[model samples]
Target: MLRLAPWKVASILAVTFLAVLLLVPSFLGTATVDRLEKLLPSFLPVRPIVLGLDLQGGASLLWEVDSAALTHAQVETLRDDVRGKLREGRISLSGGIAVLPRGVQVRIADAAERAKALPLLRALDQPISNAIIGTAGHMLDITDVGDGSVQLLLTDAAINDKIRRAVTQSIEVLNRRLNESGTKEVNIQQQGVDRILVEVPGLQDTTEVKKLVGATANLEFRLVADPGDPPNEVDNLPQQQGGQIPVQKRVMVAGEDLTNAQTGFDQNSQPDVNFTFNLRGGQRFGQVTSENVQRRFAIVLDGKVISAPVIQTPITGGRGQITGNFTVQEADNLSVLLRAGALPAKLTVVEERTVGPGLGQDSIDAGKRAAIVGGVLVVCYMLATYGIFGVFADVALAVHILFIFASMALIGATLTLPGIAGVVFTIGMAVDSNVLIYERIREEAHMGRSIISALDAGFKRAFATIIDSNVTMFVAAVILYLFGSGPVRGFAVSLGLGILTSVVTAVTMTRMMIALWYRYKRPTKLPI
Candidate 1:
């Protein structure tokens, strides 16, 4: 019990030394870490903990999804489908086919033909079931408004489900956009039914994020109707020139099938974005170009025609490039948007918060001060209570802290304000573990057990209790991480990891240190 195996001694020391080394980068700034990264070999691990939005002061934005536009678009699509289905069914109507406020309105001038048209239009209604066991509904509610005019509005359940899906898709799109922009440690989560909360750490100017997230970069390839075609005749996209060009409403190839997009310099040294399509997209593009070789195809991005070049030849390879009046940054941004895909609905920034660097620094300083004070008080109390054994425990406590920071850096965790609180809270937890072992030792020694026997009995007796307490706390931390978001998740991460590392250092590392001390000194009495 007094002697540690040679392997055990080496393992404990090696871990402690490595932990100390890992913590150096966390304390140092980015320049120092960057220098070390360049100077050292790739084999050497040298990563710092990424600070979160609360600790480092970045941008926080709350965006609302535009569900109205989604409904309008869906209804427009339904109008086209109804037009096709009615025409195919040889059903004739008298008044006019127009989109009403509630839904598509088809007025039949002939009252006798109204009965025949109603049954055909009712076929447009689709089943809507949000839950597996719940009652399903139709996508459209077809009803006669008045005088043979049938109105079709989206069902309530379907609209609610669409809004939920739109919010979810907006979050996913924002995440991909931030990642593609070389931003790290971003938190994007759905706040409510229609809102998304985004927190980006270490970003000062949120203009780029806002632009990327807000830009409805919905790309589509549409056949040009004619240069003289009016806006009312077809879907018109504004050109870089003064006038607008009418284009076919039907999409030739969607941006969703674009597998990759990269910024590259054109042959004339102008910045352009090259995009590649997947198999289905490639086939569609090939067919479209082959069928309309001499016609001009418009590359429409966000309802604007960026380019309208003649299809000189069939592009069967699925590779194409967009050449426009674009700067390097604009080309790169477009590539990012194209690669990340488009959001499901437009996003409106309903709320925004930007944290300054000075504030973040102040928070970091306050956290440091609290940790120092707490650590000092803990060390002082431990030493005052059990003398040399307390000193050993204090040493273990420091090592435990080092392990926490080291693990966090290793996993690239974002250290937020709540995470710092978790670390501070862990300082006390470390002291508690030592107190448990020390008090158990004192109780054993008072029972008249020999010093060596008492020390061994103390650790063995307290093992189960220590395990139970740490396990329960660890489980709670896991629950926090699973259910929470942003700062709460950061706190959970630090706390959970701190508990595991503290337990190891508290029990195993402290035991090893005591065993080494006993082996060297041959002590007659235990310090506790």
Candidate 2:
């Protein structure tokens, strides 16, 4: 028997509040969770362990972004910009600049032209500003000194940094878009400076996701020749005569005018994507149609012509239809893509897997069965060995589990098989504290101490050992969580929380019960 002070009683109550936090949300659902989330301080760390798709029977996607292609396109665009600036300055050079494997070089007719061209090249640099321009005899060699280049020898580090930042930003944007579409448990990670990995759990329409992710949404309005029209004798139509009404030809509107799109049935009962454009797109379409009536217009997406229809008259309603040879699924996917827009860089599907809901349910069931059996066995063994004191420890162990589960529910941590195994392992370890205490009590009793004296001494002597063991395990779990990935991290989470709750229940709650019992019905003889 032992006596607990008022401070100890208050401490026990405070610890019990943690149990309430864990269990209340589980029973009440997300509304309570939302309230708790807002009420909790921002600095208070309470991030829950989210379940992976394998355990939850959801969708997993592996996408690879083509950073190399993106880099090449960006570099080419920069080169063109630089060339335009050089031409505008009217500085005649011996040869046009060429992008080399290492850097860029331009041969000038004279050393004076090279020196005059250096400032113009530097001014044209929008992305690569720290360019080292030097005259190598009659030729000027331009090398990026910044750490931003994609090539090995080019020292431009700024562009490389920008690429990494852009990739990260793109992932964040994609994550927001997917989340808006109600996808849960999404994991978006940058696989290098250029590639990205997106995992969306519970999403079945992977094709739709791919389409949405692939589009760059770069809307451009261009006038294209109708296929029905005779091929233009000239290679390219000279710039359209400004303000001149040339013979009306077929005109087409691009997808940029689209504000919203959906999959619906056409009059022929065939699946089609219906689109509505914003005011700008609608006005542009209406003008093109009004001016080019009786001519054919082509609808294009990502450079490929999808449809061509004759302009009957100006359409001002801001709405249009895309009729195509489409199946129901195809139409739905196209609509989804159009609505989501497109990614800046293309995303290639690197890996994919779908787990059925049935498998997840089975795992849940098996986990529950194993946990119950293991917990019951642990409780029974502890009670049998420690007699009356053991029963008190068993009660504390029960409280520990209650708090553990409550914490999970409160934080919305997904319970998986490995997580369940963590709980079972905790159950086996929870007895260590009680066992140490009981052994110390027995040793004191053998020394002929009174029951109350032995009980007090036992708890006091065991406290140091209990603290040392649990703290070391807790430190190990923290390290595991910091470094481990996926399921291994889950195990670490449960173990760390278990050690915390076990100490509170075993030392605080059990001590209180023992203190109250000894105060009222003080026993001289030991039960063990």
- What are the TM-scores, per candidate, against the unseen true structure? 0.64, 0.53
Among these predicted structures, which one has the highest lDDT?
Answer: 1
lDDT of 1 by residue, 80-101 (tens): 8878877877778765579865
| Model 2 / residue 130 / CA error / Å | 24
Model 2 lDDT tens row, 1-528: 377778878877776776665455545545665677678853343444345465655666777666566666656665676678668877775566567643455555556665676677766433443235432121123543432222112334544654665676677657645543321335567775567777654456687667667666543334445445465521232222222111223334556567888888889888888888888888887787788788755555554445556778777788777775877667766776677666666667778877555346776788878889988887888878877788888988888887777666555455555667878888877778888888998999999988888989999999999999999999998887667655566677778778988888878888887888777777777777
Clash number by candidate, in order: 1, 17
How does residue 128 of candidate 2 score in lDDT?
A: 44
| Total residue pair clashes for candidate 2 | 17
Q: Against the correct fold, how does model 2 do in TM-score? A: 0.53
Clash pairs (backbone) in predicted model 1? 103-152
| RMSD in order of candidates | 9.1, 15.4
The weakest ten consecutive residues by lDDT in model 1 span 176-185
